[model samples]
Target: MRISDVLEKFDISSEREDYATIHDIVESGIVFKGTNLWILIFAILIASVGLNVNSTAVIIGAMLISPLMGPILGMGYSIATYDFPLLKKAFVNYLFAVVAGLLTSAAYFYITPIYQAHSELLARTQPTIYDVIIALVGGLAGIVAISSKLKGNVIPGVAIATALMPPLCTAGYGLATANWPFFFGALYLLTINTVFIGSATLFTVRLLRYPIRFLANESQKNMANRWVTFIVLLTTVPSIYYGYVLVQKENFTQNANNFIQNESFIEGDYLLKTELDANRKQIRLIYGGKTISEEEKTRLSQRKNIYGLAGVSIIVQQGFSVSEINKELSLSDRYQAEINRLKSELSHNIQQQDSVIKAQKLGGQLYKEIKPLFPEIDYCSASKQSFFVTSGATRNYTVVVLGSNQPVRTNRDLARITQWLKVRMKSDSLKIYIEKTAI
Candidate 1:
């Protein structure tokens, strides 16, 4: 058997549906009214809620049910076939759907009590070159699925992979919260997804040799081609810049991590935590055991260049103590400084004592509230804990410790409990630890 003959066995032409059937399917989906409009609205709301609470399952459900793909696919198909009327209709309906989705999600976010930006919401606020690739590949897969006789689960999978709805909802979130950065970032990401997906569809449609509906003269064809090219380029060039920014951020983070893990250590003080802020190009190190001298800090900062962090700033903070204060002061000055330190320590001690008492009371109240829902929970306690975060800062989190007979095995159950705690406590920075008791 020849190589060409063997390759022919894998040809997709045999399984493709009729061109007319494919055209009808694409055209039928372009209209966003009645069922499709309602579905898009509901999907947007669901996605917003998912982002609000950071629920992966809910977000996936929203993606699966979204009807936003129709007009995007239609736009691509019309461009490929030179169907100007269909393109206009698709563009109009696409605008309508986007407006409706944004409005619905914005309304939900504006009225919701939980206003914190969860991890899921934050994820959509940035678009990298990788997102462009996903959108393009997903568009290709979507067109192939639509053209095939046996679609199976490809369409829904493509819809989820392309992720058209979440970014829109995220932009709505930015609008409701009056967070311009979030709004603009998410909008840019949405543009990336939209432009690339449509571009991919156009490429695939041309590759499949879909019949052109409008028979035009040479001048008309050139004009139409110019418009399409302009639109694609207008959306694509910015995405390339964003992709470059993303690459720079990833490299900074990697270098910071390497420096912290291997290079950042003091001779006398013990490093407790290290925080990296890629956006600010800063690294902060916290020491607990002892104070670091200015000379040591200077030496440490000088080593940054060796780890590919020449322009990055390094900040070092040490545990506070009266003994760590400068010893060059006179006796009177030293005494006054010691007295001030004692007063500050006393005040902090009293505040910490009060916080502990309040935590105990809150823990008991939460246990009572959660007992009925999770009968397996035998004990619960809540307290405040300090930790370093990605922004080169320390944060205080409400930590809940739970003792249960059976382990919380499923992520759904864990997420449920976490969401409940966050809402009840009105604390976005909350952590839960479950300890398994012997059966």
Candidate 2:
């Protein structure tokens, strides 16, 4: 009934599996050959497809079946037990699994017509502190499950949570597309997962006092500890920095949104569209209804600091006059008619309170109509954008931005989409922009 006795009742030592059994399980999972190699290939391909299509269910299914956890666990266990031969074997097999996974997924991505980077794929590219924590915790859970008397669904859940397969597939995607940023980012994430998971296993093994397979002198032990420490530090510091960057981005976005919402109305003009680029620390504000003066623009830009955006650059663009348009479009009669019609429509839309609503409705219709024709496009949005022209003039154009899961391979494909949007939307002066979303 004492506190110490009560705590003793919750001890995991009583439920621990034999050391020999745990060792056998870890060792058996290390080799990448025959069934294991085939399974890994299939899993990587499935994950790649899932990422290409942006299917969460499919990605989870792939993770459940991945054999990547085996070699990682083997490395950790071998290192903890001072079994150099087993460590060497595990390291070799781990390399084989990584190479196999990368090659298989890369081949699949290369052949697939839809090779856009989706949200799911992008999610893996940036490894943050949260990912590191998940991998470490997942590893601890996995080792515990394997060494426990009652093993259930923990291993599969750990595999899914840790997400060993997707990052590898994403890296392969980068390889296929020759996108070095995507490749390095995803590879960095995979490395973080691997190192932290192995580190976690090592920690748990030491805690459980797993018997060492070989004896080592003081110098050897010190050398091994130093190497492990170095590896852990190398993997962890970057993730911490990435996590900080992620936080800064989120804060910037939130602050930018606040600034836009609060300062959208400048004198008589109204905000038509706002484009925020967190990477460049730039905020582009497009206004309509009335032209804003230099004084008004300066006032608006100065307000960014109130919303915690001190260093952010603000570019303000306002609606242009019909004479400005006439001067810019010194072309055929057809082009003149198109510009005149666009001007009329812009005037009417600017007067209406539901211009945003109309834009949203048009976007939905565009998406519905375009989805079947362009299966690569994941989303589509139609908006009236005030473009800052090279002639120091701003012109309003109906911009249809298509978020494609794959890259728009050629100018012809973009032209086709642009033509289709013009006809469907009944606007001759419409512009088309394709933004890569996923792969």
Model 2: weakest 10-residue lDDT segment is 321-330
lDDT of each: 0.85, 0.86
How many residue pairs of model 2 clash at the backbone? 9
Error of 2 at 178 (Å): 1.1
lDDT of 1: 0.85
Per-residue CA lDDT of model 1 for 1-439, tens digit only, reads 9999999997888989999999999998989999998899899999999999999999999999998998889999998888889999999999999889889999999999999999988998877778888998999999999989999999999989988888999999999989988999888878878887788888889998989898767888789778878977887777788789888888999988777655555554445445688889999876544668888888878888988999999998775443443443458755654454444456556777988788779889999999998887898889888999899899889999989888897999989889999999997999898899632
On TM-score, the candidate that comes out on top is: 2
Q: Estimate each model's TM-score.
A: 0.71, 0.72
**Model 2: per-residue lDDT, tens digit, 261-353?**
656555545444567999999998755546778888789778888999999999987775434434543467436445434554565557575
Best by lDDT: 2
Off by over 4 Å in 1: 319-439
Q: Any runs in candidate 2 off by more than 4 Å, and if so which?
A: 321-439
> Cα RMSD (Å) per model?
22.0, 21.9
State residue 430's C-alpha deviation in candidate 1, in Å: 58
